[model samples]
Target: MEMNGSQRIEASREQVYAALNDVEVLRQCIPGCDSIEKTSDTEMNAKVTLRVGPVKASFTGKVTLSDLDPPNGYTISGEGSGGMAGFAKGGARVVLVPDGEATMLNYAVSAEIGGKIAQLGSRLIDGTAKKLAGDFFSKFSQIVGPQPAGDDAPAAEVAEKKGWVGRLRDSL
Candidate 1:
């Protein structure tokens, strides 16, 4: 599966970029993330527990950051195993663009699942992926500060914009 999206973070681009590289922040934001320890400037070990439908599993893995461009963006890739449960491998490229005092964070990611977990079907996986991504971004936006989680009402002028449709869909 693949996901690509963007959000306006209330923090500065530099601050957001630095926070993106911080394993502690990542652990705190990632749902089910149990622990993470940095092994080097670009590598870390992590443990996470995940539940989908009626199945639950604990995963252990190593994450590596590559193609760094400091205070701007980078690519992250990792592979994890969950014993008899399954295995997952994925990669994402995250970019930070300055937006006044805030940061416009964008990302594109791809992932593959295998073993028993893959048998659950794509609809479940797709829905869960959307939820997980929404949850993560919501938490991150909250931490970065005000996210205008305000009224979704759109002006007549905005109703004609393509992005306005997305905003309406997201609000739902």
Candidate 2:
């Protein structure tokens, strides 16, 4: 399957780029993510549970970041297996453009599945992928975007009080 879309984040390109690279931020943003651990600057391992159609399974995967351009963007790719449930692999090319104080995030995705999951039909699989992508970007934007008016806690202070995820959600 293939999909593409964009979002306007209420943050600078630098902030959005940094957050995209942060494993902790990704752990929170990804729907059904159990954990994400950074293995290297460009690699991560993740465990996620997903329900597609009537099949629910836990997936263990490795994600890689490539074609790096610092605050500009990068391509993210990954593949995972869920035993009899089947396997999935996909890649996304991401671009970040500065729009004044906000950043416009653009992405193009291509994915494929094999085994039992593929039998679920293209309509089901495509719908699931689109929903998952939307969920991920929406949460990511909310975390790294901007806080509402009258909220003035410094990020460090928020981190001290509520930890990294909270700080990212509330301050950064």
Error of 2 at 100 (Å): 1.5
Residues forming the 10-long window of minimal summed lDDT in candidate 1 = 148-157
Flag regions of model 1 displaced more than 4 Å.
Answer: 146-172
Per-residue lDDT, model 2, residue 111, is 88
Looking at candidate 2, what is the lDDT of residue 159? 62
* Candidate 2 wrongly placed segments (more than 4 Å): 150-172
1-172 in candidate 2: lDDT tens per residue?
8999999999999999999999999999999999999999999999999999999988899999999998999999999988899898999999999999999999999988998889999999989998998899888987898764554546444566786787678754
Question: Model 1, 117-162: lDDT tens per residue?
Answer: 8999988987888888888887778766654444553452265465
Overall lDDT per candidate, in order of appearance: 0.86, 0.91
Model 1 clash tally?
0
* Clash-forming residue pairs, model 2: none
In Å, residue 93's CA in model 1 sits off its true spot by 0.6
Question: Model 1 clash pairs?
Answer: none
